[model samples]
Every structure is written in structure tokens, then in C-alpha cells.
Target chain A: MINSPERVAPDTLARVQAEIERLGFRPSRAAQSLKQERAGAWGLELNSAGFGRLGAILDTFLIELTTGAAERGSHVVPFTAADSAEPLPAYERLVASRVADGFVLTDTRRDDPRPAWLEAHRVPYAAFGRVWDDPGITSWVDVDGASGVDAAVRHLADQGYERIGYLGWPEGSPVGDDRRSGWVRATTDLGLAHPEWQATSTQSLPAACRAAAGLLDQLGLPGRSARPGRPGRSGPGVAIVCASDALALGAWRVLVERGLEPGVDVGLVCFDDTDIAEALDLSSLHQPLDRVAERVLHLLATGPDSRDPAGGLLLPPELVVRSSSKPAGNRTTRKEK
Target chain B: MINSPERVAPDTLARVQAEIERLGFRPSRAAQSLKQERAGAWGLELNSAGFGRLGAILDTFLIELTTGAAERGSHVVPFTAADSAEPLPAYERLVASRVADGFVLTDTRRDDPRPAWLEAHRVPYAAFGRVWDDPGITSWVDVDGASGVDAAVRHLADQGYERIGYLGWPEGSPVGDDRRSGWVRATTDLGLAHPEWQATSTQSLPAACRAAAGLLDQLGLPGRSARPGRPGRSGPGVAIVCASDALALGAWRVLVERGLEPGVDVGLVCFDDTDIAEALDLSSLHQPLDRVAERVLHLLATGPDSRDPAGGLLLPPELVVRSSSKPAGNRTTRKEK
Candidate 1:
């Protein structure tokens, strides 16, 4: 046994390998790699407690990610971080223990510490959301929230309503800012500019309702036309664009309370086409999570030794128009605003 | 060096161990156990594609389970099962590869092949739902759906609605049947025995809506008092206990269409207190999933060689009352039904 070629006879090694293959006795990842190769899993650190209101969206994204990874013969190892403020300890443990080959980060925020840690450790990873302040190159796949609001503006414009109002989350959220930028860009191109109709608040139903109330009250009955050649028309017919379906739900309730018909009097658009949007029959932007998951895996598959820099992908959001954005009639009704 | 105790000097071993501890250098789970003691992970198989409309409820349950597992110092390795019929392949791979020490199974059904397979393999595991037909000893933690529905029925009875109806999923489903049986037991106890008032259908909003419509039509108005001295009742004065919140949402819509006030004219109760229930303000049965998860982990911690037989737990569901089940008035108004 000691004098065998390379510690084991070549013929014996080949025979054992063949028998192992024949019996389909697959070896564990650690045993197969001699503890040097892939862990055969991907890490995902989640703030299980922090996703309170947005848990549905995050869960759907995770499901998609898991399905995509399974198709590629991998598993997603979900670990919990005590809180969002400190998520690095779990990632550190995962990497140090070689529990996963790489990771897929979600809920990326400003000055996020995860990307830098992974990068410094030479670990392969891809983020589902973008870090706003990070200048470093990284792999990420994000849906363009701004373009979603822009499309909503165009859709409402095509329906003959020009005065578009924005109801979004407060100033700091990268996602909220991106969505608000879409409204800004779309309205600028259309020349139906009414900047003062914009409103901002926290990402909650009550907060959105209060912000929507303020915007609607300020956007009260249109007295004069903003666009030229439409003197007969009242002020820009108002359409409210929200950062999320939750906000849109609140905005819809506000409209109902004010005796203003949603599809008839005001156009409402919500981002993140969740079931709430479907139940409420509100127009919303649906992110193609399956496609996003596919792209994320493709990016994360790059090994740490790869020479190429980390990649990035921005997917388009599909706008689903429901009764909330349906036109009441021809452009002639613009005067009724 | 050759004569050292256990192949290493005691002083050297102690110094190295102290340094490792001081550096907080978490050795890989494999290295920590001489690569044998524990995998430090648990297997959780999910059918991302098949959940469809019921995905939200499952997602919440998983989140709670993840939190509970994290508290116990373990990570959840989520994998995708192609379909419900064949969830064994993933579990087998996980166990044979030693990727996970054990599993926490969910969505267990009648004649489930999982428990038997795990038993045959002598793999440590516990199921979140019970096996209806399995006589073998197994560990499981399940919420009593029947008891949940019974509570809903009783809550409605106390609110002055003696003539209660039931809406549930079709027969053959262990969960659906269990929930339906609760309605049976509770109504029988209250002496409001109207078995004909029960309805069943697939679990969906439209399907439940159709079933609710049919039940409402069949139970048009109170012809004669099932109870004495309620002749002045304007309608049947019935409340519908649903197998799930999805069904309750549909029933609530039907009530709105029929111009019947949910809280005043009719009572509504839904099982599985999902966010949809909270959003629509319909009372529902809230399962204590955190406790269930903790129990599941405790059971799974037991190895196959343990002397104790497999354990089972049946936790009660708590009913949350919302505006949907408010009392119309005292028994004096019972005649109005």
C-alpha cells in the first residue's frame, strides 16, 4: 500500500472511480474538492425581521433566486442578520467557513458594507439591489424604477392627462430616488411641467396617504391650462405616481374618500406590481424576477479567479395598466379637470 | 515530537487554541468537527413555481422558521423541488452529501413519501405538517385547522350570529378537510346544526367568490327560525368561516356586491391570518409559527440513534377579530335576520 504509484495504484484508483460512478454514489462537495473547490452553495443574508411591510416582494425575489440556482445545480443558503445595521458578521462567518461558494446580496443601501467586505475577501458575489455611494465595480442586477415612473407618465399622457404628480418615499432611498427621477424626466419631455405637485413621505400606507392628501389638495381643481393651445382645458389633469404599490393603495383610498373616481377623475400608478396592485386593480410596474434571477446567477457564477471585473445588469420593468389608469374618454374631457 | 501526547504537545495545542479563540477565527464547520460532528445547516425544500396564489402564506411561514432557526445557531439551506410529487430527490442529495444535518419539512400531505423515506434512511428530520395516513412514529408540529375554524365559529356565535356557514377547499385535502371539520364540530356543539350550509371549492379568489355566491344564493333569507324568537330577521343572519384568508377576501367582495354589510349584516372569519386579511381588515386565525419553528428545530436536533421515539405537537390557532365580525346588536336584533 505504501509503495503504490502516487499513494494508490493507478488501476485501483480507476476501478474505484468507475464503480463509484456506476453506483451513482456522488461524493460530498467537501470530499470531492479536497476542501479547495466550490462549496456547492450560495449565501444569502436576510434581515428576516426588518422586511416587515416589504417581505412579500423580498420573499418572491428569494424564491426566484432559489429556483434559478436549483436549475443550475446549486442551493441558496439563507442566513439571518440580527439587524440591517450589522450584516457583515454573518457574511464573514459564511466566507470563513466556506459554507457557500458565493453570495447574492439584496436590499442594498447607501454606504453598504457587504460589497466591500466580499470584495476584500476575494469572494464571488452579486447584489440584487445597487449600492448608491459605492464607486467600486460590482456585480448587480436592478430594475430601473425611474424608467417605470417615466413609462407611467407616458401612459397617462397618452390617455390625455398631462399634469403628472409624484408621491414617493423620502429623499434617502436609492430606489425611491430612482423612481422619482423617472417622473421628473418624463414630465420634462412632455412639457406639462407642474413641479409643485410632487410629494414625499416614508414607505407606509398612512404616510403615503398624508403625502397624497397634501399633493391632491395642492393640485385642487385646475383653473388654467399649463400646455399651450389648450385655453379651454382646466389645469393639467392630475395623475399621481407612487414609489410602491403600498403607497398607491393609500393614494387610492384618499381619492375614494375625496369623492374622486380613480379611473375617471385621477390616474393612479404604483410601482412593484404585487398582489395588492392586482386586488386593488391599480396600474403597476412588474419586475421580471425570474429573468432577474437568471441574470444574477449568470453573474455570480464567475469564480474568484476570473480576470474579468464584476458585471452589472439593469432590467426594464413592465407596466401593467389596470382600471386605475384607464382613460375616461377622448382628450376632450381634459377641460373637465 | 514523536512521543508527544495525542500527536501534539499539550502546551502547543493550548496556545494555538487560545490564539484561534482570541482572533475569533471561526474554523469551517467541517474543520471544527474534524469534519464529522455536524453540517451546521438544515435542508428546506420549496416549490417556487407551484405555490402560485398561496405563495404569500408559505413565504411568511418560512421567514418565521428562518428566524427561529437562526436563534438556534443554524442556517437554512433552501433548495427547489421540481414538484410536490417528488421532493425526495433534493432531500436525498442534501443528506447523502452531508450538506444539511437534518430537514424541516413543510406542506406534508396524506400518504406522504417523505417521512417513510427519512425513516428508512435513518435521517434526522421533522415535518411542519402532519401525515394523515402514516401510522409510523415521526416528529411533526402542526396547527389544528379544525380547532381554528371552531374558534372562528364560536367567535361569530358570541357576536349574535347563530346561523353560521362554512366555505372551505374541496375534499381530500388534509388541511381543507381539517378546517371543514372544525365548522362541523363547533356548529354541532352550538345546536345550530345546518350541515347543508357548508361549501367547498379550489383555493382561489374567483373560485371562492363563485362558491360564496352559490352559498349565499342557497341561503337566501331566513325562512323560519332555526333558533326561537328571531322572526323579524331581515336575512339569514349568517357568517361564513373560510378555510383560508383568500376565501374570506372573496366572500367579503361578494357581500359588498350583495349590498350586505360584512360587520353588521354578515360575519366573516378567515383562517391563516395573512397580510391580505390585515389589509382588508378581515379577522383570521393566526398560527403561532415562531413556536412551531422552535419546536421543529428541537425535534430535528434529535438523531436517529436516540432512545426517545419520534414526537408530535399540535398547537392551537388564535382567532383575531376585525370589523368583519362585529356584533350587529343584542339578541333583540336577532329577529331582524
Candidate 2:
């Protein structure tokens, strides 16, 4: 038996409106053709570079999106570069066949070539993310990485830590760069300088750990005295904020092992508060994935140029303070373990 | 700048053929109406019933499956039961929309109603698990829960525990039932009667701890000479094989607090082998989710009417013995910290 509305998610009621809209629609051409013929016809298109979890994430999201379309009495045929060595040919063929209505595009680079390609060919499509150099694209929804980063840094600053440093990601990644910008802006507001102590780390946990140690080591010596009354209380009580909680957790482990109390002597924060953050009790900024997913789906549903080009939306992130960002030396700190 | 074919997901490539056919054939009048007025479309359908991590896993599989479609330059729309009060409506609407060319379904319950619904409507779709009863719908891929349970129980029993009890989920869940049956079969074969210490718990960690204690209390003091056994061998070495690693960890916490060493004096085993399992060194069964996802996607891409008379496909599970289920009285067992 199904439970009450209170027990169910809020999204459960959206179908009624969709059903209402469908009721007003005319009979499908496919239905007429199927009655006259036996074969089913449908089309699907996909294009992107593959990265493990990323590829995995994109695949799952697409399949799920398509499943609903299928239930609505449509037959979807999937298209991808997997069918051919070159993605351009498959894409062109779908458009040329006039069998597919439009294309769905993802992995759009900062200076993506596809938006112009699709537009020049007069094909209506939606983008999973935005392309910076191309302004003529029709519709697109993207995660606002800058705002997410800003939230992470702001939370750390609010928690009373000075001399914040950002453990950055690989150079030139648009998303990573945006997050790093947030960190810089936050630190700048406090009139703090970016020290050479900050370092870069790849996504690996051990790499993040090393980067964390590198940052603190630049402070020079575990028991060293701060340079007199300029008053940042410089010994070890520095805040280390990182892009992606993965690096943060890695850095956190290193701090714990170094005999420094987290939240007291050292502050650690990470972006993207995922399951790992919850498990390790790492302080982090939680990105609104649901909101992002909804926005992306909305853009994908509607063609590019369907919405206002000048309007961009940014969702706020929540900060959850665990042992990693709290002031150390308190008795409650030791008891947390 | 996004690299194409060399970086594409290979499995997704295989399904692009069907998309090619869809793009090539406008088919009949019904097909034309079903075709997009502007572009190709597919979607992600989030079943409204259980919207948690398992749901995420299923969603990810679908997204991965569609990677081939996207690469081929087709569009898919992800629509879920977020608005539908139930999963059945989402399934039904997917069939009616005429917007999707294919469908992907998952989180099949023990007695699912969606399979028959899909079959009756004749919509081709893939399922992640089999419904225990239906003969009409045929096509599903699932993890083999029984063998996983069998392997875990036997491993624990081999680790010098004479009598082990099955600490499972409620008596009815298909996964739980399958695992418990395996546990019972294994223990009985090893010449131990099924003990009455069977207890169940819901989602809470504290509740699971209570369940463990209650189950042990039901055993009626194993050290007494009430039954045929050696003096003071008490409590069957008390190996509690749990349904999931999360549940096992919950019960283990309770065991530790109650003067019993989890890996030594009291045995524990869990399923899923998630991140926590490795971190806590909990012995567990590793179900190959990545493989299961692949097979599920393959079946969906191939038309979803796989294995006949219930369309069942079983995948193997492996046993990973950690410190959590060590032999009773092992040197590694800490003396009740």
C-alpha cells in the first residue's frame, strides 16, 4: 500500500499537470503509422568524452530522462559516437534523416564547437552545461560552481578562522577555477594575503593529504612562534579550505595524524559535501544537486534560445560544521572521537 | 576541445545502432506524430517510490546506458515520478508520452506490478531485478543475493564458529529472504539447528543494536548445560550474519558496547561492501554493481524481453573477510576496549 502524501516526496504530484497537458494534445503520428505499419520508429542521440563516474553520471541521468519519454507511448532510439568512430557523422545523419526532432548535447567545452554547428544547421537542442565562448546557443543549464565555492569559503570565514588558503584543483578547469575564485574573493574581503603556503593537488586523497602538509609545512615548524603582535595567532591554527571534499578529507587525515587538533589548532573545509563528508564528519558546503538536476533537465527539455540568454541562476549551498572546522582545544573536541 | 571517440564509453556504442534505425525511419503517420517537431528526445524517469541511493544507482545505470545514444547525437529527456504519486503511474505515462523511443526501469520489488504493466502495454524496457512471481514479463538483470549470503555464512562458520545465527532483515523482503534462506541452508548443512535468535530491525542504527541484543537474549544463555554441548562453550560463538553492511555495522557497535569483540568473541558479516565496510574493516559480500549495471543496460538496449518466463539473469557475489568476522578468540580481537 502506498503511504500518505507526507511520507512521499513533493515531486509525486507533478504528473497530474503533465497529464492535463497531454490530454489536450492531438493523436500521435507514430500511432497512425503503427496502425498502418508493424515496425516501430524512434531516435536518441548522445555525444561526449568518457570519464568513469562522470560518464556514469551522465549515462544514468540520460537513461532516467528517456525512460519517462518511453512511458509516454514513444519509442526512443539511442545514438552515440559508439556507433561510429566519429561523432560528427552520427550527429549529421540524425539531422539529415529528419527522423530525429533535435539533438541533446553534453560535455560542451568552454569554447564548444557543437552549439554553432547545431545552430548553423537550424537544429533545436539543449545543453547540459554552458559554453563560454559561444553566445548564440539556444538553451542550457549549468552548475554554478562559483557560488558553491563562495558558500564554502564564506562558511569558513564566518567560523572565525584567519589566513585561509585554498587547496586548488588541476589548473584551467572552468569549474575548479570558479571555486578557487570564490576562495580568493572571500579571503580578500578579510584583507588577507594569499600565501605561497597554498598548494595544488589532484583528486586523489593521498595527493590532497600531501598538499595539506605542504601548506602547513611552509609555516615552518610545528612549535614555531608567530611573528609578534600583527595578530593572526599564526601557530598551526590556520584554516585549510579545499575544492572538492575529497581533497579536504585527505588533508584532514594528514592533520589528524600530525598531532594537531582539527577545529581548534587547524581548520579544514571542503566543497561538495557528499557521502564521504558525512562519514568522516568533515566540514563542507553542500551543493544543491537536486536544484542543479532540475535546472539541467528543464534546459534539456526545452531547446536552446527557449529562455532568456542574459539570465543565469545560482543556487546557494549549505554549510555543515563537523569536527573539522570547529575550534579545537575544547574538551568536547576530544570527546568527539 | 572535448575529445570524442577515443574517450567514449564502449558499451554505450553498441546501442547506437537502434538509434540509427530510429533516425533513418520516419515510419508511419503515428511514428511521425511521435517524432519530435524540433529534435530527438529521451529521458530519465525517477520512480517516486524509493528515492534514495539505490535509486541513484539505478539512475546512474540508465545514464550510462544512454551515453551511446548521446554520442550518436540523439536527445533524451529525463522525467521521473517526482510528480507521480507512485512508480506505476510513471511507468504508464512513459508508455503514453510517445516521446521516448526506449525505456529503462529499476528497483524491481519482490512482487512488482510494473513489469506486467509494461508487458501489457508492450513497451520494451529493461529491469534491474526480477519479480518473484510473474511469467509474462521476461527480461531482467540482478545481483545474486543468495550465494552472497551462502559465501558469507560459510566463511564465518569456517573461521572456527560452531553455531551461527542468521541476523537478517524482515522475513519478507526478497533480498533479505534470499540471504536468510542461504544462511539457514548453510548453517543446517554444517549440523547446527536454526536458532530462535532471529530478530528484525528497520532503518535506524540504534534500533538495529536493540534488535541484536534482543535476538541474543532470545537464545536463553548459551553457557548453561540445558542442551547437548561441552561445558562453557556458550552462545554458538555468536556469529550474526546481517542483511546489509550498514545494518551489520549498527549491530556491531552494539556488540562492542556490550563487552563483546566484534571480530573475535562475536562474529559479524554484512552485504554490499560499501565504503564504510572497508573503513571499519567489516567482513562483507561484494556484489558486482558495476557488472549488474552493464547487464541491465545491455538488456535494455537489446529490447528488454530477455530471459524467458520471468526473464531472469543472476550475477555472482564475492566474500571479503575483514577484521569484523574473524574467528572467535583471534589474536587481532581487542579485549573489549
RMSD values, in order shown: 7.0, 12.3
Deviation in Å, model 2, residue B249 alpha carbon: 8.3
Query: In each prediction, how many residue pairs overlap at the backbone (N, C-alpha, C within less than 3 A)?
Result: 7, 91
Compute the lDDT for candidate 1: 0.74
lDDT of 2 at B39: 25
lDDT (10s digit) by residue, model 1, range A143-185: 9898888999999999878778988888877888888989889
lDDT by residue for model 2 (B244-292), tens: 7657756665554443556766778888775446545678887666666
Worst 10 residues of 1 chain B by lDDT: B222-231
